[model samples]
Target: MQQTVVEHMDRVAEDVVALTLRATAGDLAPWDPGAHIDLSLPNWLDRQYSLCGDPAERDAYRVAVRYDPLSRGGSEYVHRFLRPGRALGVSLPRNHFPLVPAPRYLFLAGGIGITPLLPMMRAAAAAGAPATLVYVGPSPATMPFADDLLRSYGDRVRIVETGRHGRPDLHALAATLPADALVYCCGPATMLAAAEAAFPAERLHAERFQPVARTFGPDTAFEAVCARSGDTVTVPADESLLDALALSGRPLPAGCREGICGSCEITVLDGTPEHRDDIGAPEGRMFPCVSRAVSPRLVLDL
Candidate 1:
């Protein structure tokens, strides 16, 4: 973990604040679009926020967080208690969902999901790439950096404030996107699912802010072997392989633990890995963070 001191803090909206932090220890690592850093606050709570500033700025990192009333008060603490000059431990930036190169890009953001898209939009503009951003929020007042986004992107952006109207037309967005554009979405499960249904997987990228509740389908059971420890564990129908691994004191390297983040990705030595995540898919690997084994037996390079 690397320690960083908050250099500045600014409120962009009633419930949203932007934090600019400078590394207090070693040099910070480089990050790409859709990268996030795990922050360890003073109160022993861990929170992950996406990087929203220029990726080239390694020594200084910028993030915007929204306060969710339903959330366990992590955003509230960051907005209320965290201040400039305060020090906090931050993990190296990790990218679970990254922007894939394409002729054009279509970005869909819901509320706080806009945090990551801001930097991506800037990067796209800088690269002279064709991109369009659709940001949905409760209202103009509740939306973070609404004015900033408009001013920066001008006509290339679309803001759908649902507080006044009901909800934005997802069908319209699906139809309006360019044919050859690579679609990227980050939002609630419902929005992601809708996007997935609207746009078939020809070239769709998504990052889930919350994991969808999985109902185990009828599938054959599998035996998971921990390659390093050589410990074998049986995955029963009643439990997930991840849960079984945790029960055996073999904790997988996970961040969200909900399968949204790809932090717990492992190598697949044998057996078919039932890929269930929306993150990047490298060949012959599996994201244990949210994926399950489809085959009867599997071996993992833990």
Candidate 2:
């Protein structure tokens, strides 16, 4: 964890504030686009926010927080109590959504989901790669960095205010994209579902702020064998594999216990996983947070 202080704060849009954080000691670590830092807030509230500033700036890291009335304390603490000069604990950047080099790029963002894509679009444009961004929100006022993005990208950026003109035909737009165009979407589940349906798996990339419905097959009791510790923990149908591991004295590093965060990922030494996590790691890696085993006994590197 890095000790930092809020260097600056500005309301980028309605209910959205951008924070510039500077390390208390040395310079902050470098981070690429699509990377996020886990914020350690008061009362043990930990939340992740995507890095939205220029990667070239190593002196500070910028993140935007939208006040969600439904927030589980992270955003509430940030918007209500945090101020410039306030000290904070932040984890080094971790990225599950990364920009891959491609001939062309199509970025689809919904609401605050635009945070991660901003830097990506800039890098693509800077490299002279054909890139276009379609940012959708309730209105220009509610969309963070909407004005700046429009002014900066001009014809390359398209704003679709859903309140004025319902959800745009993002599916149709993606359907017609050239074969070589890589589609990167960070948005609500509905928007992601549309993109997933339209683009091939190899050409489409996405990051989710929320977990999809965590539905799995009828879960049954299973044995989780820890490879390093040689511990066997039985996971009940009602409990998560991660909780089972922790209770049995073999806890693994974890966060976001919902599986969207990719924090509790463990290598599968044996057994087939039901593979219900959303981060989409290839076979043999499973997030014990919400994933389960298909076989009666599964082994993990732990």
lDDT of the candidates, in the order given = 0.80, 0.88
Cα lDDT of model 2 overall?
Answer: 0.88
- lDDT by residue (10-121, candidate 2, tens digit) is 9999999999988898888888889988888766877888999999988789999999999888888999988888888888888899999999999999999999999999
Tell me the TM-score of model 1: 0.84
Candidate 1 C-alpha lDDT tens digits along 1-302: 78899998988877889999899975688899889988878777777899988888878899988888786757778977888999988888888777777778988888878888888888788878999888888787777888989998898888887777766676777787777888888877777888888886877788877766657667556799889989889887767777788888887655666666666677888888887775655777877656778787799886
On lDDT, the leading prediction is: 2
RMSD of each: 3.0, 1.9
What stretches of model 2 exceed 4 Å from their correct place? none
Which is the leading candidate under TM-score? 2
Q: How many clashes show up in model 2?
A: 0
Instruction: After the best TM-score superposition of candidate 2, give how far the Cα of residue 126 lies from its true spot, in angstroms.
Output: 1.8
